[model samples]
Target: MGTATLLLPPRARFGGQRLSQSTARWLGRAHQDNVEGDPVARAFDILPRGWPVAAVTRQRDAGDAAGSAWLRADPVHIRPDINGARLLAHGDALGLTVSDADALLPSLKPLFGDAGFPIDAPVPTRWYLRLPEGAELPVLAGPARALGADLFDYLPDGSQGRRWRALLSEAQVVLHNHPHNAARVAAGRTPVNSLWFWGAGRLPDHVRSNFNEMLGGDDAMQAFAEAAGATAAALPERWRTGEGHRLFDLRHVRDLALLDRDWLSPLLADLRSHELDAGTLEFGDGRRFRLERGQRWRLWRRPIQSFVEQSPAGDAPE
Candidate 1:
């Protein structure tokens, strides 16, 4: 029998901090296999470039593919406090669209373009600061690294850091003073006040992975699979344990009941009946556990009802 590996977001549904009832029960019966991973690294078994490559793949999907060095300048909401500002919401929380982007970008583009970096948003939620070939810039962390956390700790440092920092500051000022922010505040929406810049590099010649078949991920993950000669696509309506090693991204499942119906219930049944050999569940906190068919017989261990909630740093958007 083949193995199924699943990746779960710690905060799935409107800030949900718990897994499904079926998932919790299975975890209690499963063996504590191993917990190892850098939270920023992709689950794919390749030398992942992290966000830069993901952005390139997305840009390609949007019909604006390019080979230039790329940097993600995605929009983010920064809430200032006594210590420093924290990333309030990003990615899907912004609810950006082509029209919204058209409104906010015209003012910000010339600022970066004048400084030799041109900006583009092929998809409303994803913005790019295209860097020229051989351009020298400091390494920066992606918005994912700074989400819901203090922005100061994730800012770039070193000689070129100041230049990038200055550009970021300038971008914020332009956004803050923009005429649309007033409209946004009046409408009770988060203002488009900041841009997080990271992911800088030329696209690699090839993307590699260990799995031959995969399911459930964004365009970036699918692009990587195609480049690596693997089959990737949407998750099916229900679990059908297939041949070869497989990867499943369960983060997109925002509805708890839907997750249970689509995957959790049947999965537990398969493990109990020994239809599958083994399965693994991994969380954003680098915690991984394995469930085997034989483990269902363990009567002494109590089934877990509630899982340990992840900290702010570990909790991710669903």
Candidate 2:
């Protein structure tokens, strides 16, 4: 991987998270670049929030969301909270099947349809609302942003979302009473009791990325790569040589252990032998650790954890 810069996203649990041996070693020896932006968005030059991801991912998953405004109406599982309902899980965790979607969506379509919001579920887990060009939208963030968080906090706010809020309430009522939800409850499975509306926008006229190719990303990242004219493919089992700049989006690697086994281990070996030159390991928490072939000799540093490795109780970890 000559001169190819490899980048990874921030770890979700970095505050008290332990790094894998290989990950700890490589990061410990690297120098912090002190970069200050969401690394993934920075890579694609998209905003950290409010990026038109629904339209982008729709282009990949469904192929028909372009040339119009679109918003994700993803199926979600929410639980009641004292404050309000809290978003529990969505997408893959819900195990949404086409049959499940078929069982749930029919009664809800006319609600949006009558209100001039055309909706469809091109894929089982991903649904889209094709809003008219003249329609207005509030900030419709992705469901991931609200995972395990209070749903009302992330819901569209104020007058802009009044119509959406009303429709969403109606949809929730419909899903809550559906026979499918009862069957799911009987089967010990969580019901897809709500819909998440987010990523609202039309596909942009242009988008670009510095990387020549992208590795290991979801539909949205693939769409970003495609829109920017960059080649994309599944992440390989191990690091390999490549022709141009390559990006490995690690957000999907929920477990840091897999990151060490599949990536950081191989990276350290290659970087030491000059098989891989230099690159940056960027985290979303505003730190990009930089290292090169020659710099790999620093074995004096201890295993690093998190961005700064501070303890939760204001003491360093043993």
Candidate 3:
């Protein structure tokens, strides 16, 4: 069996704090494709509007933090036809086309044109892994390590306790003042108006559903417990049965302050007093992360592009 790779840009992980060195690594390996435009442009036109989108760009002035922008116009979308025939089995699997590949190609071209990129082409806009129905899971980067995350170290151990781990980490690239998310925060729009990118993976559908339910609720703790139970029920039996070490679900929430361990532990405890769920709370260093039960950010994982320098001289400039 062969493996497929997905390349996503930083804006896909909207709410997380880490955004520089690691994002640079991924962008480094990225390249623009050379192909036709129609099918690829159609794909972009079809993406769900108001979702947090990420892409490497030749243009540094990409606007909109939660709105979509051009990534690349390269025709890499057609390369799978040459590299591997079976790669494009689904609409979601196709790479990018020439018209928009540039939008996603690393922004480094202005500084260094195609000197170190691996494959410069447009392929699919959204990167996903549609594994064979029952194939062995492919090895991929761990979520915490992927997003410059350092929050999973606090999970409680033992039979009655459960662990929550960061499944995927995405960083959102936003302008200093973009209206999409900012307007929503300033009472100009509601949380419902914000767009978010969440960790990528095949997870229980309820995880996302539970999060959406709390998007506009007043009682966050109550919403959190409901979401927690929903997420717990959605987990594979092994995870639910004391065999899991970590789990986390990112969603757009209202308050960032409620994420502190002290705040969450007590609230979680209070909620569980009525329900016998053994939920424990943990926190991440606020400098790089916000742990609120529901914040306007959901963890989204799409294909992220990282370029590998061909030679010492081709390396991206610091």
Candidate 4:
């Protein structure tokens, strides 16, 4: 009677790679589909229709910003090798503890404070900075984009870009030689050598979503649901039966094989039993497929080969 949506990253199929058998079969059965240009952008589009809410800001404000713009100050590792420098995603910045953050805060907070941005470390990996009212902030890419890619292009840009750039440069130098990082290196762990700033915005008073419940690990999803006056929770071990539209955020799952066993198989069974009216699967690489119970009878459609098998050389699946 209602639609169930699944949002996942594009790791389902890379160039010349294929998904697990169950997932591939389900993709072939979908009745409607579209490709998005950016997986992250498309994933956000499925949320209860609202202005872009700053995730780090929402996490910091905890539903009370009192009117202030916020930016993420996520910890990161700059990997250097023959390929030069690479900024690891926040998740990949391994072994960084709260104590490490506390040790480095004194040395780093003053830099941001001097630049007029006050910093706060609610969590070790996810930090926040409060921007002055009416400050013009530059558009910066999320850590997802910076992971394993050149960081130069993803830096903040726009009116105040130069100021932010200078601050970031200074931060790198300070973090590079921090005693905490040196100790981390001594312990054979990746040192936290840089900070990432993005997702800048103020929390909106009102947000709306089609779903009655939002289930995921993402704080933004929880914050959005709270703002929209809906129920939000961490995903359960098993999906519970519900009546209204529901959104399941599975973007954190990067392994297609694991997703097939854990999610797609169960969902396929639900569809065949007519337990769900319709279901939509979104991939991180910008492709989406939708299937309804009635569409299952279209037996003429055959399961496709692995996405990698169908993809052209050096191109993503279409």
Candidate 5:
């Protein structure tokens, strides 16, 4: 609706992954030039890994003698917030009142600064709710979780994509009807986006492996696909939007679907169970809040992204 504002450079690194350096520089220039829209910036940190290469030169020099140099990176889902209410709720979950969350603006640097690689800086701990349409927004901080989603055919076509839209609507319904998630949202618990992670170019093998582990066998895989197709066919036309496609974490695969309704009830019941208690503490004149938990949260521990898409055997599915 408005003139498009670039968020990040087209090539900026997502998560800790190495984005093309040229992209990062372009983003920096955009920021310097006072670009508008969603301010996209890079967050970097040194994650502990199985191997630490002291020098890439020697490794490259070895050539055939060099062992496989592998790098693993976890990706995150990025979204924009168009409304203040969702942003307020996100702040509340992190133990900040909306005003308190808003007040943290001036000290964003020193307070949120980090000391890790790529120049280190504090990663603002907050969840995002992106509207399909872009809009100017206020910063809202909160304890956050993310949902990993893929837009299969999400493009700039005037027509809306049908199947992808139906799947997203279904996912919202499923999440809303579930007592645990609904209650969490009602109580201001920021649900993080379940994002995807990649080691190389293809989908990770662990996806299929995880499904087999959860479903108890591979017999259900094909059946599951058929079931999805049938559900898609039966979906009401009113709910359909044809044009773009999305295949995020919950799009094609979801762990929740693999489990029965009865199986999910107890988990929700436990979160509501009184034995669980959560508390928060604020630091730096209410700039940062730390949530301390005393009870077990089942949904928190489950890896839902793996269930949705089988790791791309050769790059993620389109």
Candidate 6:
């Protein structure tokens, strides 16, 4: 018997009424539990040293600052509105390229250097900035939380926050007039407007995991697997025979319609054929449901309207 686990975002958005019928059915017959902690943190907990996003990702580039305080310096687009500005969306939605990154780095390097932080871009969309050791920095939110949300409330605080906020303002001004952004706008693409700082901290000394394999496109997942001495590979379209435990991250399936077509349907078929002994589904928001081969016989467990109920106002679990 083999076991597999799937990690995904919440099946539905906050206040969203439409339920994923197939997902609901799958969860209805499974043993469910609401795990506590950030999904990224939880995923890291599965690995040896746990979730050190900055350290693990920095290691991918063999960064000198891998052991130092570091943060993700990812490029982002910000749209200005009457009230204020908000993040455009995530990188995947921006269609950024290495060429874009190369063209922009030199122009902005001085600004970051002058601000006491040096930036590095090992990949097109992903960037890193090394901070002074023991520097007081705010507990900033990740890009996911600020995606499509107002930037004002999400900015840092205190004297350090003031400096960081000013740095962002200066960067935005520079990016707005940069020839690269002008060319981007001319080419009918969203301009690379600003930089987002997040996922801060140094790498952990050690890490561990229960799984033998981890399959996903997620950088953090792959990094964690590598650190934990597990076989990490790009996610495959179909499951292969394996022993021990495996984790599949499918958070890229942004909507229920695509989730059904790309993942749920195929996974359910695999379950029906007994190709798998057991499987678990985790919505990053903390809800986890486990399904075993024997549970398939529980036909009386009718599918619910939604796999997760709308979290109470101001009480939603992270």
Q: Output the TM-score of candidate 6.
A: 0.84
> For model 5, how does the per-residue alpha-carbon lDDT over 132-218 read when each residue is reduced to its tens digit?
223221222111222222222221122333422343344334333445434445777543222111111111111111111111111
Question: Which residues of candidate 4, in runs, are more than 4 Å off?
Answer: 11-26, 35-56, 59-64, 81-84, 91-95, 236-243, 309-318
The alpha-carbon RMSD values of the candidates against the true structure, listed in the order shown, are: 5.8, 4.5, 23.7, 4.4, 27.0, 4.5
- The lDDT of model 5 is 0.22
**Candidate number with greatest lDDT:** 2
Of the two candidates 1 and 6, the one with more favorable TM-score, higher being better, is: 6
Model 2, stretches more than 4 Å misplaced?
2-26, 45-50, 237-241, 252-258, 297-318
- Per-prediction TM-score: 0.78, 0.84, 0.20, 0.83, 0.18, 0.84
Q: Identify the runs in model 5 with alpha carbons over 4 angstroms from their true place.
A: 1-160, 185-318
lDDT of 6 by residue, 38-107 (tens): 6645645442333457667788766564547887878898888988889986567778888888889897
What lDDT does each candidate get? 0.69, 0.74, 0.24, 0.68, 0.22, 0.73
Task: Please give, for residues 32-140, the per-residue lDDT of candidate 1 as tens digits.
Answer: 5335554324545444344455345655656455566777788888998999889998877877778778899999988999988898888788788777768884467
Q: After superposition, how far is residue 56 of candidate 4 from its true place, in Å?
A: 6.4
lDDT of 4 by residue, 179-227 (tens): 8889888988888877887877766544566777788876656766766
Q: Report how far off residue 275 is in candidate 6 (Å).
A: 3.1
Model 6's C-alpha root-mean-square deviation from the true structure amounts to 4.5
On lDDT, who's better, 3 or 5? 3
Question: In candidate 3, what are the lDDT values of residues 187-281, reduced to their tens digit?
Answer: 53221110111221222222122221111111212222242342222322111112222233222222323232223333333333332123321
Error of 5 at 236 (Å): 52
